[model samples]
Target: LIKITYPGLLLEEILSTIAGNCLLCVTKLDFSAPKSLE
Candidate 1:
């Protein structure tokens, strides 16, 4: 059971990291975009 579960947990961690990075990038873009447009 431990072996089977380990890969799923690792995959979740990787996915969460990627999602967090994407959110950070999007937030940065949202913050900067209007200033550039104006």
Candidate 2:
């Protein structure tokens, strides 16, 4: 069971990191290019 749980924890950690990066990118883009297409 340890082996099975280890991968699950690792996957969760990776997913959270990716989500955080995506949020940061979106926020940065919005701030940098607000109303540019207008």
Candidate 3:
């Protein structure tokens, strides 16, 4: 296994940032999808 350190973006910060970005993308997609497709 390999280990590394992030002085700026810690593990929790990275995870939450990714989750937040995904949530935003999902919400936008939800808003963009056509009603006929639902």
How do all the candidates rank in terms of TM-score, highest first? 1, 2, 3
Per-model TM-score versus the true fold: 0.78, 0.71, 0.64
Score residue 2 of candidate 2 by CA lDDT: 62
Please write out the lDDT profile of model 1 over residues 1-38, one tens digit for every residue: 86476988878888999999999999999989999999
User: What C-alpha lDDT, on a 0 to 100 scale, does residue 32 get in candidate 1?
Assistant: 100
**TM-score, structure 1 vs. true:** 0.78
Evaluated against the true structure, the overall lDDT of model 2 is 0.87
What is each predicted model's overall lDDT from 0 to 1?
Answer: 0.91, 0.87, 0.77
When summed lDDT is taken over every stretch of 10 residues in candidate 1, the lowest stretch is 1-10
- Model 3, 1-38: lDDT tens digits are 12256545567788889999999999988888866487
- The full ranking of all candidates by lDDT, starting with the best, is 1, 2, 3
In terms of lDDT, which candidate is strongest? 1
Better of 2 and 3 by TM-score: 2
| Per-residue lDDT of candidate 2, residues 1-38 (tens digit) | 86476998878888999999999999988987866765
